[model samples]
Target chain A: MAIAKICGTETEYGLRMLPPGDHNPVSISSLLVSSYVDEVQRQIDWDFEDESPGNDARGFSLESAMAPAVEAHLLNAVLANGSRYYVDHAHPELSTPECTDALELVRYDKAGEAILRRSMDAARRVLHEGASIVVYKNNSDGKGNSYGCHENYLMARSVPFAQIVHHVVPHFVSRQIFTGAGKIGSEARWWDRAEQAPHFQISQRADFFEEIVGLETTLKRPIVNTRDEPHADPQRYRRLHVIVGDANLSEVSTYLKVASTAIVLAMIEDGFFGEMDLTVENPVQAMHDVSADLELAKSFRLVSGRTVTALGIQWELLQLAKKYAAERGLDCVGGEERGSDALARWERTLELLEQDPSSLSRQLDWVAKLELLEAYRDRTGASWQDRRLAMLDLQYHDLRPERSLFARLDMERLTSDEDVDRAVREPPRGTRAWFRGTCLSRWPTQIVSANWDSLVFDVGSDPLRRVPMMDPLKGTADQVGALVAQAATPAELLRLLSE
Target chain B: MMPERELKKRSSASRQDEGDVAASAGAPPEAATAARQGERIKADLDDLLDEIDEVLEDNAEEFIRGYVQKGGE
Candidate 1:
């Protein structure tokens, strides 16, 4: 069912050149990404032969919706951890290796933060005097522009795309109550003259969305991205690349964001949600409105003309998820036990938000940020528009523990430091990442390039041998671990694979 | 809204970055207002440039070239 809910996260970290100046983000991003690849792991090229970002799921791409180019000359590398650390659109983007479960995704996501931290140090050694890369696990530049932290979930090809769009839009619109990373002031150009001018928003990425559905990511960003490029067996799976989430610093927030969404997707595929019409009239506007409403009392017009607050909608979804678990089971998200844990956590979080949003200061990003900002505002006697408050908001996302405002706060953590550290060097054993990471680690010199579904090896042959891994469920540690252990060289591995 | 007493009581215990608070606190009201005004202007310019970037990104061939030219590739 849904191929083990195979999921991954891609975060384009917000970066600034310290001793801030008019530095080219593209060059600095390239340097930062390359420093990690050059210093930390074996560098392998990303094969773009199968990439077709222009292919829209709706059978026709918008004429204006240009697909992201596969730039072969860029500083792209497949790490020994099976993750891709590369620069995309002048941002240092770290895409976690395919994960079999949500919790594993958290560990890998935390590992990505560590890798970025290490990248900063490595880049420091090479950067110009008095210049350094300060990375933030944030979505916005605080200048009306926002980056992305996209999540990928592998779903069965049998499920209709229209159903996915209909079910997910409400969750995407309402989930910000917990998933939000918090933002200072509204940057939405359209919301500039709204009746309720928000002093702060629940989510950093919510204000930047311009469409409910589309293929473009940088411009006219959609809540449910329509890019249908599945890096696996196309007939068997479709990777739902979600670009609507924030780059969360709170571990609990990250965990819940992935887990809850996975559970909802599972529920959708299992037909547990019977005629659930949670559609908002304008999803783009609703996302901003939900985030801006501090009281969590503002309601959006549903398709039925019924109004529901973000919290109310989430509560309904949670109840359905609970019933879904009771009936079919939650094996899609690790196991029934893990699924129950996600549900319990979701219920508790919603309860807290309902009772008092501030009660979740330690459990959620938006609450913690709100508490910190309010505290700062009271102490300094500053207004919400104060530049210091804005700076404080940005500092909350800083990656450095010594300087990070979020790190100082008593936020609840789900993953251990050891797990995060280990995840930086190793891949999750249950996915194809194990095969990809093992090859890169064992024979760094032999492997020429790698991607999600395959690897190309030189193996001393006149023609490079391309090993096809069309299935995400195959080539896992169980399937290839013994074979990998037995092979001594790339040539031997190639020969073994041929067999 | 937090009670004034509650805000004062908790803020001192919760506030760790004294230097940051002081930095923002040190700015004079007039200077801060002027700076905020400047930021608004700059934000307006940034919005315009981003719109231009969006237009460039809409075209397939031009977007690819721009991607490389902007050091994206």
Candidate 2:
């Protein structure tokens, strides 16, 4: 049986510094994060000592591959919500903590958005009247360059990486049918001819993929990223770093995106995908084709000599997932109850795509945005090449509540406002984040820094005390809530942890 | 906050139906609509476009042209 698929997401929002003094993204990105970190809680630096980005799953280390560093101007604050609000390259990135289930992932991810929104307000108060920062919960800035909304899932280190690469690519290529954040026209589009170019695409990240599988994320990007940083015991675990998805504005899109992928991963870990081969002949080409295919009828040849539409491929995967659920209970990827509900929603989503994709505008981001673009075109009789639709595309992802086109659409919500509000301040109670957050809130003055697997504490001794969290499932509010409450001090907590 | 838009869209939809009695395709046919939220968004599509047009930023094309970003992971 597969171990529990504890998962999370790291979203790097597209941002820009409006003109006045400096438009450099790095500086503005740092400012945006610092303002947020400054207001909510005392700064807790992210401990970078554990990061091993160079350690690859492909059996070789690119020692030259270095993780981004924290400079004086850049900020890397570990929030009390167990999220990392920091500057990643040029964008403000938020990494949610380990979530035991998909629903918890949604709430925490939304909390990241709310955090970014609040950061915008905080920055505006400090910036010159005309100079300000604008943030988009999106992937592209219309340039050839793109950022990422990466997903990380914990799986067995023994599960062969080759099997994961082969089985997961087809799903990643096709899942964009529902997971896309919607983009107007193609950036650095493959086809140059007017006839071959797409007016709009379902995915914002599809046009940027150039490889099927690799470790490189920014340059020569790959669909199935092989980043091997487990942030856990390496001998027992492997963290699957997925960089193919778009930064979603719709809560439904984000929910489905993470849930469906986590379920697929759980199946792979259990070897439930025995003898099932859904590999596309060319996954890179298939991803682009699926994204450009507005009619959802484009079919591509599979490695097995059968051609299947993206929707058809999803249906086959769903059928297998249902079988897996019956054979072995869905105790891994979110418990059986939530897992069953997620599968049902996945089935209904595919059915709607088959019958009439337009009917799902209220639940899918790409469809919702597509409908708005169509309405705009019908009213003004504009082409897909029109720039106004592009602005509309950008505005839909705006973080500001008043300006965000997505907020006005009344899209379906799986998490409540109260839950999102609480998620912003509090961590999910089911995971190790509860312990991390509770410690930070209780003894912010003594804690030095935090990482996924350890927390450093300054207990006023010559040496600092560090608490190691190796198991993502351990240190839950259930496990350590009372232990933390009774300690009353960092030194006492360290003593309890040692015991 | 949201009820205002819903009420306005519904009232205008009814008014358009009453006024479009002479025209065949001017108003969205009531009998042909689905009760899905999406179908309702389509039914009041005109009002949606109007609201969007009213709130859209000035000089949007230039703003989009200026929105360029660097590569990241």
Candidate 3:
């Protein structure tokens, strides 16, 4: 009944090159990305011809500088995996290819970490002695600033934006209980009524949110982002750009975050929540309040005039999800097995949240992080603001396998290293990414430039032939895997595709 | 020729880990004794702390103080 929920994630990693040589974040980020790109293949630049981040869903365009500035003097590389790895303003950002489901997203997301780790290794070899780069899959810099781990979901163009905001705001407010990569304390010191400041919060990005809906991501951040850049058929789809989440290191946390949100999107697309109101009285306050409630017992008043706990809100959503699955079958979040797994995990997570959240130390990032921090406190009796705790918080998200505290935890995993290695090189076969990636890997030297919906190939003389792949569902591995393998050159491949 | 690639289709069953997490998650909510689980968690935290001691940054306060960066969207 619902449209198949195609989704992806873009993570901007925190970059800090240790001591010695130059440690400007932007330069280090550029080095990390360009070094990795150059080591493997010819430089394949990202085409910014189609990106329209300025086109706000609220109607008129704000300013077109976000893309124009990135296009100039940026190390934007389109990966063989149909992902984009580049310097986003200052952070080294990696965006996964369009994934058909949440589970597929997990593998691709892990692959991104592998790529960044390799990038760090590559940068180290080229840098001066004692000058090394470090990357953290985290949101904030422990200062007043915060970056984003944004999720993009495809919604039917016909679905009104207001309806999306109305239905999704409450989930965004409450889902932080599990989606959060926990932090030490509030970043908004101005908003801190010091007596009431939470020592620790469930979400790293919660204090940063100040609006209910907005186009601004870095400032006056919104609970529901309104960026309307559909990198597909605009007449048929809407890309819901979500920038409120934390950069998670836990596989289960990432999985549940994407999967549950996908399920909710499916319900929204199918018009399943008929007249049911799940609105928070004030979403920005509710988002921060939910994050601050460590006891998980704070209640917020809803538009329906009933007050409910964040856990209560999640349970209500979960019940509706189960009913939607039973009635509609979860084809929207990718077939029965993956959908069922999402539903089951969602249920188990909520039940654990209510009965024993500490038990989820192995499943959720915030819980695992809290457990690690608390364990450190028990060992040394350090307060929340202790420098050791802050370092521990940042180290938990470090990208290095050996250095990453997340890697050491016995966390529940939805993907394997073997699978992640494959994902690092290959794209998921269900979408056009299969064709896009297959072409790039096979014709690496010949490809001149690439982007989300098209690939321009250099065929030695004739104008660069651009193969447009606007339909996200077409050009699957099932559809083009053999064709890609059989072709000897980009010229033949283009000819065959035309034929 | 294109490199030899494995499908590596991740199965739903792979979501289950070989840790106590999957076991406790699969167990009925009421059936898992919360108090005993709490004790086990306290015990596990002890084990985790031992591992953490080895991996923690040597100059933690200095490292954290110097870890600032330019944030982005």
Candidate 4:
């Protein structure tokens, strides 16, 4: 056994205010937090100190220069469980400390529910006072936009980055069925039919993202961040930095989403899952394909050079999930009945793909192409020089809500620097985080300001470990070489070198 | 027994005499005065009864409305 340990935390909530009327809803959240803080503190104190086998309560609080009146009024108190629930930016985020076991981690995560329930009760208490809080677990609103629900994982630097990517990428793309916090609008729209539900689905597209692989603290981040920040034993551990998921509401979904990836990575390391044939007709096209329709399946080559459908791999994983659930006496994986539905869908998809792979490929291609064309029209203008060429733009860069200089100009007119400057100042809400500084030159808010509080964990560990996964599509040969070079051992490097 | 009969006859005779005196006084007939007194008493009683009935009706309506609205029914 690799002695697996898993812990991560994030908050995904929507911003809402009372409509201008006699009722004021924004203040309600604050009032609610204040009223329930004492009760919540009492509950946490009982759970943490009173229930502990030993009365050892130290090394949790840190002194700060915050005004005492403000702190007391805000209920800025630390709990005995080594978890602090204090206001973060503007959101209430409950961050769990790295736990020794998965069960412990889940228990700590559940504490967030208790905290939220208390807060809601407090809100109801002062409902007459007038303030309402809106919670959103989505990354972006319906109209091709984005927000943040970050992920943090602890891993060992001893594990080769290449191996991690191979184990993690497929699961990352496929995990959306369980982990996706449903969406209301289409992700991609057709150019001619701009009004159609633009790629609207109820889940995060596992594929439509940028790949910037490095630890450099710049304005732009790699889609899969590998920056190592050791919070524990640095010599032995690495923390994987993930920043491309919509916050999920369902606890089971969140657990399955992260835990399944961790399990797959472990299996890959233990040689349980064989090497996958990772070749794609177009790596960018495939990513766009995956992003456009999560249900779309692709054929991946196995190490044996035999082509296997993505749906086939999912079926195999579903069987493993069934076995895991049975052994653990779990009613279902992630406490969800729908996990079985997902398994069934994969089985059905595999059978269909087995009958005819080409038809599936063509269908996926059509979807991918249509999404690309619509994304381009939305980004550029309606009168694109070559509608077919839009695929290049969609793959070359992520489609943000911002417009380029050429995009604003009439197809016939030339543009000036002033025109570009004005457009850049106030880019659309969905501009890519990477391009905000470079193109828009606007410093976007890095620290999210939420009304909810967060818990801080000092695990007393060394630097966090990070392993970068390769973009199955769009990653350059040099980038792949760099990742291969970072492998800890010769054997791992040799595998990639041979390839 | 003879004394009791005499007292009753005297009381009846006095009532008749009082009625004759009020009728002869010409303000109003004694029977009309009695009917007015009876009507006044009846109006007062009806007002009290109506007040009680309104209170009960209002309370019952409120209780039923509250029960159904709260999903109690």
Question: Which candidate tops DockQ?
Answer: 2
Scored against the native two-chain complex, candidate 3 gets a DockQ of 0.47
Residue A213, candidate 4: C-alpha displacement in angstroms: 3.8
> Listing candidates in order, what is each one's chain A TM-score?
0.97, 0.98, 0.97, 0.50
- Please, what are the lDDT tens digits per residue for candidate 3 over residues A252-359? 999999998999988988898998899999888889889988889999999899999999988988999999999999887889999999999999889888987888
Number of the predicted model whose TM-score against the real structure is largest: 2
Interface RMSD values, listed in order for every candidate: 14.9, 1.8, 1.7, 31.8
TM-score of chain B of each: 0.33, 0.42, 0.51, 0.38
Tens digits of per-residue lDDT for model 4, A147-171: 4555656565577666655555555
C-alpha lDDT (0 to 100) for residue A296 of candidate 2: 99
Question: Candidate 2 or 3, higher DockQ?
Answer: 2
lDDT score at residue A65, model 4, on the 0-100 scale: 21
Instruction: Pull out the clashing pairs in model 1.
Output: A74-B73
Clashing pairs in 2: none
lDDT, candidate 1, A343-459, per-residue tens: 899898898789778767777889878877776665568788766666677778878655576765556788888999999989899889999998999999888889899999998
Better of 2 and 3 by TM-score: 2
- The DockQ score of candidate 1 comes to 0.06
Model 3 shows how many backbone clashes? 0
